[model samples]
Target: MELLAGARIALTPRPVERRHAALEVAMLGHCPGRVRLERLLQLPAALADMRAVGYGQAVDAFSSGAASELYNLPIPLQSSAEFHDIFPDALTATTEYVSLLAGNKAWLGLAVDDFFANGGEKLWVVRIPESAGQAGFLPADATQLHDITTLQGLACVLVIPALGVVGFPDLERLQIPPRLPDIPRVRLENFEPQFLPCTQNTEDDHRERRYSSELSDMPPPWQLPQVLRGMLQYVSSHRPDLQCLFTLPLAYSGELDSPVLDPTALSALSGYQQLPDRAQALRHVQFLFPYLRGPRFALHTPVGLIAGQQAAVARRDGPWRSMAAKPLNTDALPYPRLSIAQTLGLRDKPGISVLNYRNSFSGGAQLSLDDERLVVPALPVADYPVDRQRYDGFCSAEVMRFLGFLRRQLQALGEQLIFNLDYRDPRPRLLLEQFFRRLYSQGALRGASAEQAFSIRESTPQEGAMLYEIMLAPAFPIDRLFLTFANLNGEWRSEVVDG
Candidate 1:
């Protein structure tokens, strides 16, 4: 038997080819630059099948087990979390600064303005009734919402207008500048992927930092903040409940020394550890402590080992408060429709996967399970980085590859599996970057602009979002291939079959 992309089975229309072996989808989008279309062995057929899918989209949507209307949640209105799009995954907007600082303050004002001007839809998020960001800190009047009208006028006048001029309060226009500023705004946001520091090696972190600074365009200490959720705390015996978001360089280890923990970590794990590898350690603990469950997520760094570390301190602002640092349970969140119509808001999204026939488990779009329902696990290789930095040289990644056997098994079993491997957003610095010549980019974009709408977000429209970059953000490009565990006798066997 031979597997085909989209987990579909396409034998050699010949009689001898069908009896020899089967196919499966061992891995999907596992490799970058290249892909393992599928494997074949001792078969009479000359050709086999292949398939693929893309960003915010998956083969599950097209699978026979797919549901039609998974994302049909109840209607909602705007609220506080929407403004500044409170970055659940971003680093501190400002931190360790004796002050919000002149440069930082201006940047803040500019960011809010830009978010609205570009495709940023308003969720009308407001500051808490008693707020967290400002209160007696900046002049009460200075913290005015987006100066939309002024910016819009600045549009052709100050900047460009059609980029959909957006501003807070009531939207307005811009007041163009006279020949642009000498220092064109440079927002070096890195929001999509940063390696979570699993092994807090201070030296290693610094080395990474130095590496970045060497190539930085900001020049000197005028660097951008590191957008990370370090041990951020809110001391509130008297101040308005403050919610601070800060970022530091990936190289900054909380420890002053030991920037790189193990220079030979990849070459020799045990050998590298025992050779007097003394280094300082740093850790980041993120949580909503006393957590609330509307919509919350952190900017997960594409870290190899530093898994997600989070906990919550509930209602610390209100009367009672306590703290706990439990690991996050992703399953608890509502698993909305893992469908294309729902994900892209369009009908008939397609997927293709190659099922390797050789594997024992082959055929079917899904496999029924002993448990009441079959569930897919979270994406593997959680910290697989695929941004500009990670791909600088010959870095190895746990890329997607296809195994023919598993492909056929999924199809025959008729199981609906979830495939959620996020490859969106850059680090905060990159997200906020303005590496362009235009005064205003005409719209919100990370590297370049595109017409893609509907970003994957943690909360409401107000809170910051994991911008759904279009074709530019795919971890795996759209291919007409996929395979399933149709052959699996039960779900347990299916899960264990593939790593």
Candidate 2:
């Protein structure tokens, strides 16, 4: 743990300012250098250091609603002859490789690339002609997606993780992509938004790091191959012996949020009884999960849970993941992975999430504190992580909604929670962040001069602000739990906030 000696420090402005915020001078008197400092990064070499501590790659997350396509290497969604007409030359090359995967394979692959200090390769170049309102899209089943940047340059090859595939040109062939013309002069005016540099690692004092974990307690069966690939990336890039993800089950206090029950909810709970349709209730949900090497956890998704279908990522044989369960008690200290506070601090997220769990923070935070559940509302996007004791202004929408719901479900329950109208939109970082924030704000503007600090970057804006409202749910008990997750929507929204 590298301790900070003073209060303030200065560093250069990141080529990319908004997300990869490396302040010209950072205040670091209290926080240690080795802890939060590792959270920021200016170079790919940082990948090794992160792996050493405990970070993993997130791939193919877009279709799953977790990751987005913008960050993925460009790969065709389909390889059928029918789809080829719309594929770009690069995607065409990528498909050729995926086709080699034995099945009806698709992949992200690259043909020509080379970029270093003087220049970098174009990260994306999709030239699919527009059709009758349809995108040149492919399905998640596609096996391969080309990372053009990784294949084109020696710099990419030099900075690869230990295991996993990195397809560079057959160097013995003595061939490389043509470099862009020399730069005679430089000016801010020449910048084009689409042509912004890829968000790459930088050489800054404040490092920008990323962390990932399986969204659900169990891994989806369909995610096996991708899980294997991710595992390879983790095994090759990181030394998990020193650091890795610490996963609590669906019941663990780490992953879920906890809130007191309202009177109505208490009433409902007292007389709670199930009809016992095990098959229907268990339809597409998983019961257990296995930790496939890497940051992934395998799960047996039921068939009935997929978007349109009732069933989803079910293992071919039977059970999908390989995990058993045990209850979590106070003996468990900091979670297997970063705690909620640590996660918010590291990610620079203004608020926190509890996904769907509403009882994670039921335990007493203090040794002698009352057993009341702690609930706090999510913060606005602008607010950073702070000491819980110091936060009196923030409210936990999740808790209010949960307790409000229990008020109706459970009878005579007493649960108090605050709600906030403010929340920072977690639109996709690269593009969507700007788009939605722009839509909601009176006159938000991307600096006509704003550009990526690194070479590889993707920005995505969500439709929540435009199409629907999105809010964060951070619920802590007044005395017990600190953070919880649950979205008050549909009937719940009407019952909790609207009412």
Candidate 3:
């Protein structure tokens, strides 16, 4: 009876839980604010009921001239189909009359609609002022730079750790004012036109009948570059996890003429010779070019579409996947229809992503991203040795995004364990190992094995601080492929050749 002792057994450890990363975008622009009570009272009963009783705070917080606010897409407002139903009068309100008007000419509404249509899920909106005096495109002085409305919106983003992308759909509008035609007066059938005569007026009577026009000063050529440089510096210094998306201002000779792709204009916008730390600052920004023409709107910027595509890819695949060569989801066409040579010219240039049509395998022409390139300094820093700097990883958008994701995950881990775990604890090292192993298994790291994919080591500790150095081989997308076709021994043969 003593021989029948119970056996002891050990159970298997549970798998480590992975965090779900849902990419979110922050959009700052001039959007319609809360409809006034009087305006609401005048709406149709069905449309009026769309605004729920409990959402007053959110509505007021996002009202015209209000600070930045967060909103979950296709909710509260239900869906894109109900945008007008939820806020009925935003479409018709003009800049001069309404407190907050929908920026139709500026393309704010169109950008929002396009974002959701292209698979964006979460959004943070900042409703800035409409007039030039209240909110200039770029702040005039150092004091005003910190107080810029866009910077205020970015401040809101900093509080939310999950927001990864920031864009200003109306940012280009500040520099390029819309050119409107002059209004003509109609002649009366039976009565002579009467005009008021005053000592102040020196023009003819008919001329006095014309309405006063709004004048917009032409912004300086350096205005946009300076603004972009400031934004990039801010993002690089404060939040390395976030990416700023911008559309290069369209180049045109006259207000009435269509936009053209001017090399000199692009050079002015991207040239960073004046900055001491151009490489560091440029890595945080991605510039898109050549405005698009869609069925819903005549003309629109590419930033909204790029942001949506980035989110969609991050959700479906990993953030490390390249967005290049992906077909655009909207029914838009690249305006000014670039030729093959023109497309190649844009592709050769760095720091810009161009939209162009590519022939698919099925022999159909489909619009797709030619390449996804990050903005990087054309020249190496003078202070550093040429061999010491690695620009290849920074040049690839996918690689930079992967690095950002890695930084965010590591920061979160450190924050969670800072108080409880000791610096020398073996558990922390084991957790990091497990995390990298998971990433490697998911095909995010490029290597034959986990050891080759990544390495983590605790560096020499200083007073009250522990530092860890991590080196990872991030996965990269194929940028080029070569094929050769030849006839050998009266038989045609084709094979892929590596470069």
**Alpha-carbon local distance difference test for all models:** 0.18, 0.21, 0.58
lDDT per residue, candidate 3, 169-213, as tens digits? Answer: 766545443332222336546556566567666444544211224
Instruction: Give per-model CA RMSD.
Output: 29.2, 29.2, 14.9
Top lDDT: which candidate number?
Answer: 3
**Candidate 1's C-alpha lDDT?**
0.18
Residue 293 of model 1 has an lDDT of 12
lDDT per residue (tens digit) for residues 1-499 in model 2: 1224463553322232122111000000010011121222222333333333222342223223452222222221111121122222322221111110011111111111111110111111122211201112211223222332232121112122221112211110011011111112233353354543578643442321211221112211112222223322322223111101111121112223321111232222122212122111111111111111111111111100110010010111111111111111111122122344543332122222211111335663311100101122223223534344355323322132222222222221111111222223333233334433432232111222223211223233563232322232222223213343456663322222211
All candidates' TM-scores? Answer: 0.17, 0.16, 0.71
Error of 3 at 115 (Å): 1.5
- Better structure of 1 and 3 per lDDT: 3
Give a tens-digit lDDT track for model 1, residues 1-499: 2449865974432222222111110100000011111211111122111111010121224233444221111101111122222222112333211110111111222333222232122111111111112221112222212332221111101111111111111010000111111111245565586676888653422121123223223312211111110111111111111111111111212343312111222122223213321100000111010111112221111110001110011111111111111222221221111233232211111111101111123442221100100011101222333231332111111011111111223233222222232333243223323221121232212243332311332322345433322121212211123434455566433222211
Query: Where does the lowest 10-residue lDDT sum fall in candidate 1?
Result: 23-32
How are the candidates ranked when ordered by TM-score, highest leading?
Answer: 3, 1, 2
